[model samples]
Target chain A: MKINFPHRQFAHCESGVTANLLNYHGFPCSEAMAFGIGGGLFFAYVPFVKINFLPLTTYRIGPGSIFAKATRRLGIKVIKKKFGSPESAENELDRLLEAGRPVGAQTGVFWLPFFPPAYRFHFNGHNLVVIGKEGSDYLISDPIFEETVRCPAADLRKARFAKGALAPKGRIYYIEKMPVHFNLPKAIESGIRDVCRVMLKVPLPLLGVRGIRLLARQLAKWPDRFGEKQSLLHLGHVIRMQEEIGTGGAGFRFIYAAFLQEAAGVLENDRLIDLSRRCTAVGDLWRDFALLASRVCKGRAVGQDSFDHLAALLSSCAVHEEALFEDLRSALVR
Target chain B: MKKNDVPQHSGLLSGNREVNYAVDVDGRYILESSVGWEAKNIALRQAWEAIADELTVVLAEIKDGKKSALAYHMVKNQMDPALLSQYSGVARWRIKRHLKPAVFAGLRPADVVPYAELFGISVDELRFVPEELISPLAGLDQVEADNS
Candidate 1:
């Protein structure tokens, strides 16, 4: 028997899962609200970390973070687990599904058979909800898609235990108890403050707004250091991380802007609504950087759009984001 | 982003339309269904091209018998020796050594079982790659035909 679970798509997976799961448990939450309340925005360009032989350029916090943070702040008790073996993991998941509790599962994108073959890569951190099991297939509520999906139990097992870099190890989580009384305004305030603090005050140069600048510096030097082919590959990875597979670059910014717009209504603060528009403007700058960088990657730029110019465009994003976050902090103060 | 400005095109080749946040008439943020965007597609294409390039080079090396079938599988799966070792419980050095055609040829069925299991193939299937590693971009044409 399939548990009746409402499936709704969102721009990002973790937030979407959180929103859907919370909505199921009696708290009506949108994906944007979940993301904003969780303070899911992050920017890190660490050269030391490598994925598929390229340096890491992540736009948001890793998977599972949003659900964990959003739920914790909202005073929802959740049971989270990671099994040592795939067999144990499968048993636990099956048990939960039998009990009529829809489970949030973390899996690698590569082994999920339902995904478009071209889009499947070995990136290990993807989230989905499994609501039912019937005749060797599990029904899935993957947040990135419009409708629900299904996966064979064997393939689902493989995806859950997919190895290498952020392996899921068959991790499963679900809410234990949803809080009926929690401070929504305080949650919104803390979440916005966390975003501002991380954006503006992170001491590390390879994180926050500072990280954007670091990426800018490294990006300009790529052509000389790694040659044209490798530099273009690096550029492509950055764009993919931003816009591909819902990693949330400019897409995330717009989502956050939407969240802020909603936050304004809840808090009855007009400044927040204004700040949300500025957030969108900052997101636009990021989109501009992606467009220009893509042209550079395609070698379609005739002139004035060199890596140096791209660097300037990216640095501009960092500058504007810094300003936006600083303004956000003051907006939260009153 | 304006709702009108949202890219209504589906993914470059994925045949998926995704929700993107844009603004409505009164400037409220609304989720728009984006077919896809040119810039994002180009980036995705570059990745596929890189994979195709590496596969071509690896396939040539295998034809020359300098590398084993395992080498082709590894590159095709985007796995390095270190990563493959971690998953298959084989030592990285041994994985690298096994990539040599002669060494792979000397391996027994039992010795190849771990790799076959990891790749979800039989020991015999692991012994050789197909004549062609089809470019993922070509799948779009297949998808188009299926739709039509």
Candidate 2:
């Protein structure tokens, strides 16, 4: 069974999946718009949580939130399910495909056979669309890749049911209803408000702008506390999360900047234009920090690249992000 | 970032292009495609180097008969006993015991099927290990992150 769904490749997964599903339902959402409306951008340096045996330093919020939040904000209705059994999940997915509805699935990447060797890891947060099935292979529209691919039924089952942190648990979702029209300005404003509020005012030192500053303070003493080699390893891990793991570089700051520009046009607020530029500047600072930290990771000698210097760069990002979010909060307050 | 400053490095994401928001000549934001970035590549290489170092130690232990081939395979997959046990449906204590060559050698075919299937290898090939140390993780002809 196959349906004629036009698939567009995107830089990130959940937002792309949201955009594609909404467009298919005739809602006509762009990826950046979906990301912005969903409040997709976030930062947290949770040192206690472990991924790949290192601290989890996520560039974005937890997986699956973008789709759920974006759909909610746009006033679209979706049916989502997580099945306890692989058999039931496969049956439901096959029924949906036979009914000619394209379904979005949350899957573990490690068991997905179509991924290139380098991209295969134990990450369970990857999102893709099951557009159709031919014989036993399911058609996949993975946003990160340039084109659609295919995975066999058994492998798809394994991916859907893979065990680990953030396991997908045979999850599937599809749009159930599309509104005639949405209050675009309202949605945009609400998204901007939520992001600004969380980034600036969250009480936990581990959560928001406070999190970045906390990371900065702790990073300076990592070499003394954890020793040089371990500190470099953590530095390298943070750099990868900041630069490599699907953030469009600089930790999605540029993406949010682009969103702010579009939000300005939609909301007819010129102040957002200035905030957009400042956000872009903050993104540049993060790129600078990542570049310096990568150097620090490479310069393994005890004091070759001063951890203090790297910490200073990170502190500047925290400083600028605090200012940018403060301005955004005030911009929305009026 | 400006459109010109995006680094098109040949690294981990070789042959695959990702979208970046860059400012064009008009200073308007446009989605630009990038092959890779140097800092990301370094970070990736750094991670794979640490993995490679761990695998090297595991391989030496495997050769010295202090550890079993399961130990080498586990390290290659970046799994410790707890993680391997989760995936393979083996108990943690049993996994630790199986990491010894003497215990692994006496195990029956049925006892190893879970692991062999978990790693997507045949029971016999689960014992396979590369002869030498490996390089960075991005791209390589010899150690291409494949268990097939």
Candidate 3:
């Protein structure tokens, strides 16, 4: 049995899955729209929280927030369940498939057999939609893939139940109700305000723009503290978090820029178009930082000057982002 | 990024390579597969090499009886004790205790099942460090072959 769900490949997994599922349910949500409404853009450079033993440097909000926030703002009803046992989770997922409801699930990338071996890692928090089940294979709509794919039942189960940080624990979610109408402008305003607050007003020195500055300070000291090879590894990890891990492009700045462009149309506001362009420019700056950092990582450059240059780039990014979000907030407020 | 700036294909020879972003003719962003970006590929290789280095140190520690094989697998799987506890249905304290080489050596088969399953290896394999754990670049050769 299959639901004939349309699969659209997207840059980021959670927002893409949210948009696809919402569109499938007749809400016509685009990936950018879902991302914007969900307040997906964020920055945090937490030194204490370790990912793969390095400081956690995330470019966006945590997983599952986009889906939850977008659904809530749009007045969509959804059922979310996490199972304690694999058996109950599989049984329930099968039951949902039999009833023709496409389900969104959180899974670990490492356990999914369809993934290229190089892409498989211990990092969890991958999101996918299960559209069908045919005997032993489960039809999967993983957002990051270029096309929909299939997974064996055993692989699917293991992925869903994969152990480790951010484990899915057999989590499954699906829409139970769809709102007939929602206030696009209000939601957009709310989303903009939320992002502005996070970027500009978050009190923590380890989060928001402050966190970026903190990262810059710490990053500049890496060579002195950890030596050349280890410092390069640290730099490489930052790039990986920005470019390779689930970020659509330019550490999600491009995606959020796309969202702002769409918002300009939805709210019929000209200022947002200007902000969108600025956001794209910010994305370019992030790309520049990545390029430079990549050079350092590859051993093409070594010196205090190179590290200082990278740290300067991050500081500039933080300043630009702070100003951009402030402008967005003011534009929405008026 | 502009449509013109998007690389049509990746040039990476090893590691997990894919380009998840591109641009359409109209300059709209699109999702596309890429072999890998050159700089990113280099950085990823270095990152993996760093992990391999960490694993090497971890394996030596386990072999020297300073820590359990669990510590070796933990680093190999990129996990910490907190995360392992969450997956293994074991308490953090107990998991920490199990990290001692003495306690780990004394653990029965049943006690090791959850961890063995979590790492997708047999209990016997879990008890001893796998050969792949010795070199962090265990699978990159195959990736290079596939790319070639």
DockQ of each: 0.67, 0.61, 0.45
TM for candidate 2 is 0.94
lDDT of 1 at B80: 88
What number of backbone clashes does candidate 1 have, counting pairs of residues 3 or more apart or in separate chains? 4
lDDT by residue for model 2 (A185-294), tens: 88888887778777878788886788888888889889888887788889888987787746776888988898898898888889998998898899999998888887
**lDDT tens digits, residue span B1-148, model 2:** 9999887876566457788877788767887788778788777777778888898898899889999899988887778898888778899999999999999999998998999988888999886777886543535433322321
The DockQ assigned to candidate 1 is 0.67
lDDT of 2: 0.83
Those runs of model 2 whose alpha carbons end farther than 4 Å from true positions after fitting are: A300-305, B133-148
Better of 1 and 2 by lDDT: 1
**Which stretch of 10 consecutive residues in model 1 chain B shows the poorest summed lDDT?**
B8-17
- Candidate 3, which segments miss by more than 4 Å at Cα? B8-33, B61-72, B90-107, B128-138
lDDT of 3 by residue, A105-124 (tens): 99988788888655667667
Task: Give residue A320's error in model 3 in angstroms.
Answer: 1.3
Ranking of predictions according to lDDT: 1, 2, 3
Candidate by candidate, in order, the iRMS in Å equals 1.6, 1.6, 3.1
User: Taking the tens digit of each residue's C-alpha lDDT, what string does model 1 give over B88-111?
Assistant: 889999999999999999999988
